[model samples]
Target: MKVWFALILCWQLLAPAFANEAVPLADDPVVEQRLITIAEELRCLVCQNESLAGSRAELANDLRREVRSLITAGKSDAEIKEFLVSRYGDFVLYKPPVKPSTWLLWFGPLLLLLGAVWLLIRTIRQTQNNANTEVLDDTKRARAQALLQNTDLPK
Candidate 1:
């Protein structure tokens, strides 16, 4: 029983160490650096908010492998990026080119914010106009006074 317990404790301690091994890749420092740079600029499709370098999703892993392969093939960084863009569309790029195709993606939020501001201004102006229009004329003022006086009388 003591031997079994010792084995279990030893396994538990070493399990996490095994799990932490980095994925094997090419040993060329320049190629590795290029891969890292490209990966940082690419968005992880499966994890929309994370860069490919930061995501652990299967798709991210696959993309990292693809980048490593391209680097090993001696592709220029621009060529690698073009290949990824062709395959995955502009969404794959963290800072996509400002072009006709991506105009909405880049400017839609600003347009919506401006529209909201316009609507708020219009609403406030309309409310102010309505409040100003509710001012009582002399006849309506006398009528309101009479009504108040009548309401005060015993029913």
Candidate 2:
């Protein structure tokens, strides 16, 4: 039993040494730097809120590799970006240009916020108007006064 335990411990200790580790994206520092710069301007399609430079998703890694290869092939930043846009649409860009098709994407949240504010204001005004218009009859008012007088109020 002790020998079996020792063997398990040895295996666990050596497991990491035998495991394959992730290598750098590129051998050239300049290429890697350019890749990072371009990646920061691109969005990770899988993780919508994250930049490609920060995402660890498989698709993000694949895109990074693709971008690195483009850089190695002597493509300028603009050309690489244009290529990606042609393939993936403007959605891949962190800030898509303002165009008729993308107006809703940029302005939808503002429109929704304005609508909510308008609704809230209308609701509050309606409630105030309803309260102001309400009238209690003399009889009901007298009954309420009598009930209040008869009840032992809390100190």
Candidate 3:
């Protein structure tokens, strides 16, 4: 009983060391809010689907720290954004400005979706047309009906 109790106590003491701890964020609410706003607008390079604010990746943490320093340095939001964009390119921004180079990113998925719809419609129509053309002739229809009805007529 004492051994079991000791083991249980050790497990309880050691469990937290293996668990994730929340990161320490900026102390001031305004600074924290600014960090969040900036982070939300930026995409995590390592987690392409998640915004930096929501990503748990190490790179995201580093980027947040960079943003915190920038805030502490009294840089305007636009200036901070510009510095990040210059360093990481437009891919870092969740909503990049529309430009000649970024036109594909803005419109490519819509074009692909429309193309898919057209192809689906065309395929469905072609299948219907083929089905219409495959109707059994009179003799074959008679044979099929006779077979269905269990007639013993020789083929």
RMSD, every candidate, angstroms? 5.5, 4.3, 4.0
Model 1 TM: 0.75
Using Cα atoms with residue i matched to residue i, what is each candidate's TM-score against the true structure? Answer: 0.75, 0.78, 0.71
The superposed Cα distance between candidate 2 and the true structure at residue 28, in angstroms, equals: 2.0
- Candidate 3 residue lDDT tens string, 1-155: 99999999999999999987787888788999999999999999999999999999989999999999999999999999999999999999999999998999999999999999999999999999999899797889888888999997546
Candidate 2 TM-score to native? 0.78
The candidate scoring highest on TM-score is 2
Q: Scored by CA lDDT, what does every candidate get?
A: 0.90, 0.93, 0.94
Query: What is the clash tally of candidate 3?
Result: 0
Runs with alpha carbons beyond 4 Å of true place in candidate 2 = 1-20, 143-155
Candidate 3 TM-score, C-alpha based: 0.71
**For candidate 2, lDDT tens digit of each residue in 33-124?**
99999999999999989999999888998999999999999999999999999999999999999999899999999999999999999999
Winner on TM-score between 1 and 2 is 2
Which of candidates 1 and 2 is the stronger one according to lDDT? Answer: 2
Task: Give the distance in Å from residue 94's predicted Cα in candidate 1 to where it truly belongs.
Answer: 0.9
How many Å off is the CA of 63 in candidate 2? 1.1
Which regions of candidate 3 are displaced past 4 Å? 1-8, 16-22, 135-138, 141-155
